[model samples]
Target: MTTSIAQPSQTKQPQHVDPAKKRPKVLIAGGGLGGLSLGMLLQQTDIPYEIFERATEPKALGSAIALSAATDALFKQCNIYDEFVSLGKKTLSLQVIANEQRRVDYKMDFSAQQQVLGAIGHVIARPALHDLLFRQIPKNRMHMGKKILSTDDQGDNGITVTFSDGTTASGDILIGADGAYSAVRQNLFKRLKAHNKLPAADDVPLPYSTVCLVGQTRPLDPAVFPHLLQDDCQFINTLGENKPWAQGTVCWSIIRFVEESKTSTDDKNGHSIVDQEWGPEAAEAMCNEVRHFPVVSGNEVNPLTLGDLIDYTPKDLISKVKLEEIVFETWFGGRTVLMGDARPLNPAGGVGCQNAMHDAIILANWINALPSDPTSKDIENAFRSYQDERLPWIQTASNSTRFYRTMASGGIVAGLLRFCAKHMPAWAKRKMLVVLGGNRPQCSFLPLVEDKGSVPPAFQPSLLATKPKTPATSV
Candidate 1:
């Protein structure tokens, strides 16, 4: 069964409000996917917002990202669905194999995702997706090299964020969409800890059980790489003794999980652990370590290796990063809130980017409905509403991510999961797909996209709770 996308009959007209209108001014920390997406959503409303990034310029950093129908509605509402589909290749199945023996373990079918959930899953290079999101945002609103040093939530007076360059900016709301080692989060945690209001789990340094090295190769010739000739992506995973490599059409990630959490200040060799660092030196080290790993996608006669992919990838585009599994108990406080990697997750299941965009969608809904002159209580309530609607979904995604990670491991747990996955009934698989792709959150302020799946989407509270009272004007 296949579900067809119906073009929206009407498009929502972009809100053109006077710049001087006293609406809630949003200050976003980070210019990655989350921040840029939130900014794009906010652009549809009368809300004022600006994005700040620590990087001097955007680097094409990450490898591939998997997007499901969970965000297809939001993309259609934002008028970027067509372009997103064009840039991505639809993924039909995930084939997992034992790396050393080259034996097939199990294959998870996603061909029915379109029929059951509304849209097929897509796998695109992260840089291409990032560039697509970046193009939607205005140049004037996105500030580069503005590292957030600290935040001050001044009750009803509004919030203030001080940057590394000794400059300050004020806004009605502060969103920490920065990555795992977020300065905005560190600053907020400091103030919460001073009052003994921070959760013990949220106060400590982020823990990581795995390190992932991700990179995308330059476009390859279809003649040389026969897999590239396929119309749809064939997602593959090769599970080794301790290292698992998840392969996309032109991108890949080599993940090595440790037995225990490595959260120490320094490595065993006495060198400081820069977990968030994506510098090429660290990436190169990991690249060389996994260069000889076997790739299961290629034919036995022409066996491919990680070194082939690495050689095709530009040096500057590779990155080594940590994967944390904890879903922080506290998401928002006062006027400060967190989104994206600030509330980190292990990306074993490729749900991190999806959750980040979902967070932005929900947060933007609540922010759009805010009163122009909101009091502290009103601000707090809005922030709470954003978290209330987003937290449960984040926790669910985190749980699934962990389970998938375990399933890819070489332990007994992984063996059991593989057995179950191989024997999972077709009905069970479809049910799981429905559960996984059910939450298709859309902007309440924009014209809603018609649902095309057989199964209805999960209930979205933010859509009903924060919808604009007046019908959105259409172009």
Candidate 2:
């Protein structure tokens, strides 16, 4: 399940010329995980691409961690996994510790699978990783202070982009590694929605009830969160008023584990886990409700024509998102198409980043089959092969991410479901496999052909083959 990029051994295919190779002048928008990742891939390759980040500078921000197999290897492929690992605290398991009177009722574990996936959830400040990636790619290639105004698809060629500065430029490919709510995807979706290329609103809204708070905290001193130091697993500490309290009452990010991977305790001065915390004050607030405090309703009636689930997530959670999905219905106009989330934004399963990384690796392998030079059709077919082979994995991971988060947040209902699971047959127990994100392909992002609906190529596993003796030891 860990990420493995097999050196491909495919039958010989027609050669394609790298007309856009060494002259790679890609304009990547939004310097987030996807953008930074693609830029880093390009940086490592013979291609050249520049990142146009909307932020004036790479600012330190966003909450914490995510688990991915393909992404870790992508970092390994790009040669940055070790550096990231050293900076991140690896989670070996996803434990569900059902709590009763503050005592452990039961525990469900997930780690061996994470290891096989080559990544457990990784914890690093968003800014920290961004700065690291920003530093990895030369400063000259990454531009700050520029915002995208508009993007237009040019006929049979490329994309024309207009910047906020009133300047325009054309590129062979405009990779909109933009995060969900992407401006690029938005315009494209506008066109598509107008043309009815979108799924019906009812089928898309797909809602579930969840009203929860999600945030991080100041680095907990070892004494503050003793259990966290003893293990490397992320936890859902559930305490029920009934057999199903669903812990948070509504679904939200819960932290039963806390450990900071800062170089020195003194270095922890800058990182803030979240802007708020739920403690005595919160408990008191809950005990005393403010009448008409203002109840807010949400929009889940229609999922966007573009992006992923994110556009539907509450705005309050947007800033907290460390990594967003890749959404591009089109990249490279038509000549050299792009796949993966980079196309229509990869879904947010634990493997989004991994999936994106897998895309690059698969593309590299797919291209290797072609002769040193390739014709336009050859490149087009290569793109098709890449899509046919990789899309299913991307889809599977995306669906898993959505499913896992849903169950994780499943309030009393989800908890009751898990509790009832004990009485069910062994086959029913396997249902939990999806919540653990154990049922998907090992690689996060393999290539794909939408029409063909393909599977991924071979891949290897990660160092997390077994749960670390404890989280501290692993970090």
Candidate 3:
């Protein structure tokens, strides 16, 4: 049965607040999920924004994505909640198994998510979600093949960004919504270092301990993979004795955790360090290594191998990426600011993209608060507020990602942690679930979705600060 959600006009026309006041023209670097989501949110406002993507064409990279209650309201406010549900498969439970031993470790039940949080999360393919966000944005606003080479905050004159083709675009503000190796972030940090204002932590290279090979197969035949027939998504995660991998409903990932020293140089997959170039050659190398590995979750009688699934997936959809977890101390300097994977989380947790889109929501709310012809201080203040509101949550998320990494990476510590998690009390588990699902931020300027969950949403300072002011009644 399909999930029923309130239907709002997905293509709601832009609502301008004040025609006399000129809003800021935003230059957004990167046309990934976060940037696209931000552009979609900005579309509902008077803000004029343009998205720059380095890729000449879109690549259907990565694997599955779980959309949780944290951004349920934001989707609803954007009026794309129904379509998101249609494209996604609701996940009820997660089964963790010991791969070599062929024993079920524990199952994480998420049935309470709907009752307590009002929205049980769904697992959708990354490309599907990316396309969904892309649909909400106008084609003209999104510029492909324009790589952001550098940016300059022109003080009172606003900001200007130079492209790889030597073309330039000037705007009131520049937002780095680029991925982990963001060019906008690189330029901003360079400027900060020149002025001796860059933080010690921000100056260092992004560190990672794990690399992942992820992909989603073309729609499978239900007779061959019976789990595909199930109404809810089947998430079967396995902790290998040595290396770890996980298989979702359709998407799968082979995660190999490396020593810190090994992370900086190279991996067995032949993919270069840091510069995670995703192409057929690199992905084929990793696929060959894990192809022989048995897929315990698919088909009992026939027993499919990882090779079968790899063959099932299109070559273009596969991607290999280093799972980097870090929250930079410096978020903004001058009129240039950063968001999304500019500060990424370990993909092991699957919350990185969610947090990126959430960052867009919060940042959009703050940006929407800026006045026409605002001063440099005004722009800085808005960016500061966005960071202050998101930093604590990101720190919490980073710690959570590390814990997930420890659990999935496998070792004495992981075993103990997995054991503890397996036997964790129900009430404690519920509390943790609440913590994970609680923050449901919406666009402050849009009509609010009614809160129906028993658990109230976490306090959003951006929403409260930018809420519409009530007019005073004349005596």
Question: In TM-score terms, which candidate is top?
Answer: 3
The positional error of residue 221 in candidate 3, measured at the CA in angstroms, is 0.6
lDDT of 3 by residue, 1-76 (tens): 1122333435556786678988888888988999998999999988889999999977778788877777788788
Per-candidate TM-score against the hidden true structure: 0.92, 0.60, 0.94
Better of 2 and 3 by TM-score: 3
Model 1 lDDT tens row, 364-398: 98888887678778888988888888888888898
Give all candidate RMSDs, comma-separated. 4.7, 14.8, 3.6
TM-score of 3: 0.94
- Candidate 2 overall lDDT versus native: 0.44
Off by over 4 Å in 1: 1-13, 16-21, 101-103, 246-248, 264-279, 297-301, 470-475
Higher lDDT: candidate 1 or 2? 1
Model 3 / residue 240 / CA error / Å: 1.7
- Candidate 3 colliding pairs: none
Whichever of 1 and 2 has more TM-score, that candidate is 1
Q: 2 or 3, which is superior by lDDT? A: 3
